[model samples]
Target: MTGSLRGILCVLLSAASPAALRRAFMRRQDEQRKGGPTMWRLRTLASMILLGILGILLATVLIGGILDVRLSRATLDHQYEERARIAASTVADIPEIRTAVLDGDRNRIIQPLAQRLIAGTGASYIVVTDRDGLRFSHPNPQQIGRRLEEPVSVLDGRSHVGIDHGSLGQSANGKAPIVDGRGRVVGQVSVGILENQVAHQLDEEIEAIALYSAIALAAGAAVAMLLTRAVKRVTFGLELREIASLLQEREAMLHGIREGVIGMDAKGRVNLVNDEARRLLGITANAIGQQLDELVPAGRLRRVLAGRDAGADLSVLTDDALLVANHRPVVVGGRPIGSIVTLRDRTELEALIRRMHAVTGLSNALRAQEHEFTNRLHVLVGLLDLGETDEARQYLADLASDQLISAEDLRSRIGPPVVAALVLAKLAVAAESDVDLSVTADSHLDAPAADAQTLMTIIGNLIDNALDAVSAQSGPRRVTLQLRDDDHHVRMVVSDNGPGISAEAVEEIFTDGYSTKSPRGEMRRGMGLALVRRLVYRRNGTIDVSPGPGARFEIRLPLSSLDPVASARTEVSEESR
Candidate 1:
């Protein structure tokens, strides 16, 4: 009886313990949910308030300082000009001053006039000198009756105003000739003023400006404080923690996604960058509060931020690695607020795509050859079935002769089998279409720098295009193929006598999905020129199309631009052979 009762008590205790532990776990989770947002909201609100204050203060101070300096300079210049004009006009009105020196009386007339001029103007000094060579009167009485060599301007009867350091230290002076009514120059009246006086005036104006600027700054700062307080009064009462948590959760959702996320404020400052964004940019740390350009270096990111929806791949090289960035603007309520940028590592994908294109091009060429072979076989069979042995033999002979002539011509001019085969294939097609095709190739192209497969594709596409262009002409259907190889590069030019391509179409012919042919046409379908352009770019080559009397497509590829590893492997295989 005792053992059974003890067993029942133990069972009851185990059942209660499980239920209590579950309740405790749920309570802990609830607490975490509540606390996380509260902390984040506080931080976000604080950051926003601080940043907004800093931006407003900086703009206000900068603009105010600039205005103050301009105002001060203008006021000082106005006062200085007024004072100089007044001094010049007062000296001009004294007839006694002019006559004493004009008559060349050395001692009797000049001294009293100089003293009177200085007293009336309250200037630093006045000096009167005769035109010949004598100082008749001077502020310093001892200097009177002395032989004077005046400045050249005074001797030339021209007035001069300048800052000078004479025997009397630094001074500014205005010198004018006392002229007679006949405009004949007499002696000179020299009025000197201290440089300190002008400087003092400027300083006074600057001081007034400074005082007013200080008052305005104080008022502006007070207003700013009041506004800040008002904003705080409204915002501080909010549940900052809850709002911050929601923002953090939203940001987390963005970061967790495969796409890169970036946000900027109105001041062009980066406010948010997710982990995926950092990784995409090859950045290891946070990029907040930094200029987007400083972090991205490529202006692509900045352009997206400036309300531009540039949906194109951007190649960016950071300190750590290269990135292919896709940038777009982030608009709120139909206005651009910031931007979103997505980055992808396209290096491997691009390399793979290039290889695939090369393989696919080779496959297509082989398929075309196979199709032609089947048609030739059918023609040969029909010739034999007609029971005309002699005619069949003659037809066979002529066919063999045409092939030999074409192949021999191509071999003599273009040495490589791949290029020769491409040219021969296009020649066959052009002959069937009744287009006159001419082939001119350099001897060096016998062993071209490009791989056999690449040479076939490049040459094949060009000749095919030329044949197609000439096929539509009603006149002499002529197509010319010229291949030249220099020490550094290979150049191919394919020209046709067909109605030339339009000037406007030439620029966009290489663009993807841009076709000149009708939608129902089967011959000119698919991404032909677009593929050509991609292949050319992958091989570090360039292609240009021009419309002259006829259509001309020029292709240039540097021998050294070939992939080094691929070239090395080919060289090794050739050496082994």
Candidate 2:
């Protein structure tokens, strides 16, 4: 249960612990079965990344190989064409070959020369033709005297290079014109290399291209594998499906829980804040990725969240809520990561406790009154037994006048019924304790303050502290409470004739969790004066304490109200100014 609770509560990197990741993986596997085999079929994020990179590299290699093959073929053709052109032009420029072709008996001389050049230069064949389109020399000697069936290309006396279908086979062929000394075109020289030879050259280039491409593909695959490993480590070896599932679960758990949860990084940046946290902290804007101090106001709340003020169930007073916060630091792999602070709103619970305290006080007052009534009855019974009727009657008259005189006076002076009841209860308690507790005659309250609860808290805490102060005294004990109300503010004063706060203790009295009193069970002390001070200041009020032979505390809290007439007049006056 502890492990699961920590997993659900903390959103730091620790959330990706091995156990949690395994659970997430199991959940993903179940989801995959439900969704079908195609869902997250790759299983691991690293495998998927590797496969994607390999696929891309494979496609790139294939496309590149095709383009390279095309380019190689074109280059081979150009090379062959250039070779044929050079061979034909060289033979045409020869005075012997040109004279022999023009003489019309060139087979004897040209056939041997063409064969020799073919052996040396690797030309497939060379054909000499006159202007009349008659072949002078051919690789086939039987066709040496035959006129060429095709028209003679030198009729225009220009050289040409292109594919040719000859008796030998299709080849890259170039034709060059042979001219006499008068510069008149007489015949043509054709030189060619077989298509098979060109294809052979192209095949060699394709082999090299394929080898290079394979190497590139291999390098790319290696890189992809290394990249995948890095990503896997970073993601804590969780698959994509697992990560998504964890995120969904985290969101559900974070916002679903009633307690406010805040997750911060080691650097004091807010990484996660749930809906309840936002509502409890009164944070309206997005807080993720923001600095903790920037989002939370500088106070006990911020200090606690930032781990500066550390403790369990540390009470934090916010603008409108009283919160009990517990800060837990999260460490992963023995390294400090960050922390998670859970805030539970204690405002309502604290209010109920205070109300219960009021009821308890009133109950004690009733008990005290009952005890006093019993003693009076005993006196009356004793007087009747002694036969002193006039004395008994007079005693009854005095008891009737004194009975509830303080209650009547309190009701007349205090306006709010709750405050009146609380004070009356305290009065009875003080009387029972043999301490003099009185409300000043000059004290009066017209109505309740706007934030009467805060007002009551301030007054109540002061009075309680005063009673505690007086309770320690050996001699006469007195506690005085004075309340004054006006249109703008409510003032309260509580003083006691007891051992006053020492000069050193007075300075620290209003510090949270700083109590001089002995520990009482599990009850936390020192918050009362601190809380009273906070409430007074929050209401733009002032509190003054006099270190006592007896302690005296005075508080004045401003009343918040809207008067349209006064507001409008003030605005007009400001405009004129």
TM-score per candidate, in order?
Answer: 0.41, 0.68
Tens digit of per-residue lDDT, candidate 1, span 127-230:
66666657777767777778665543566666777665666656667767767788776666666776677677767767776677677667766766665554
- Kindly list the per-residue Cα lDDT of model 2 for residues 13-46, writing each as its tens digit: 5333456656865776676677556645655667
Pick the TM-score winner. Answer: 2
How well does candidate 1 match the true structure, expressed as C-alpha RMSD? 24.1
Instruction: Name every residue pair that clashes in candidate 2.
Output: none
Candidate RMSDs in Å, in order, are 24.1, 8.0
- Give Cα distance to truth, residue 171, candidate 2, Å: 4.5
Spell out the clash pairs found in candidate 1: 37-241, 38-241, 41-240, 41-244, 415-446
How far out, in Å, is residue 471 in model 1?
7.3
Model 1 lDDT, residue 456, Cα: 58
Off by over 4 Å in 2: 1-56, 83-159, 163-171, 175-204, 227-257, 260-278, 282-298, 302-309, 326-343, 361-413, 428-442, 447-454, 465-482, 493-554, 559-577
Error of 1 at 212 (Å): 23
